[model samples]
Target: MTYKEFMDSQTQLEAPAHLTPLLEALWYAGRDEWHRAHDIAQDNEHDPMHNWLHAFLHRQEGDFGNAAYWYRRANRTVYSGGLREEWQEMVRTQLPA
Candidate 1:
């Protein structure tokens, strides 16, 4: 499903079916459940996207140092924007066609 669709469907009792692990984590993040989001994100490959999301999670939790490390892993410059904007940017970048 498209990202807009995903966002729109988020009011449901369940997450969308057959999402990638990252999308599932994003879904949980959308649900405002950070621990669940991190649980899924932690198991993902230690690649850029995972690192990026992990960084976002840590940053969300206000752990700047740990977030910096993960941001390094993701090769992304440290973000100085609001979390909601950053989250939407993540969704835009990672969103499926």
Candidate 2:
């Protein structure tokens, strides 16, 4: 199903503790809703996970510089897991191409 549909299905249920808003934003990202994803993640000012999400959003928008900046903020070795494999593959492919 579409990501927004997936997210809509999950809305009322309690999200896992470390993944509340993150998962919500992830759904938006999967749907290619960059602004919606950004809105969901915006409150997490200093969170590494939020920074990572920002990186992913920027990457999807073809803003490598901002993506890199957020990646640095998150201090991650790679952006994987949580995200769908197809989306992750897109990001992986974009790394050098």
Global lDDT scores for all candidate models: 0.86, 0.64
TM-score of model 2 relative to the true fold? 0.61
User: Could you give candidate 2's per-residue lDDT for residues 4-97 as a string of tens digits?
Assistant: 4444544544332444576667656766677978987677848887778887787777787887888898896455554466354433332332
lDDT of 2 at 39: 88
Clashing pairs in 2: none
Which candidate tops TM-score? 1
Candidate 1 clashes between residue pairs 3 or more apart in a chain or in different chains: none
- Residue 3 in model 2: shift from native, Å? 13
Per-residue lDDT of 47-85 in model 1, one digit per residue for the tens?
A: 688788899999999999999999998999999999988
Please give the clash total of every predicted structure, in order.
Answer: 0, 0
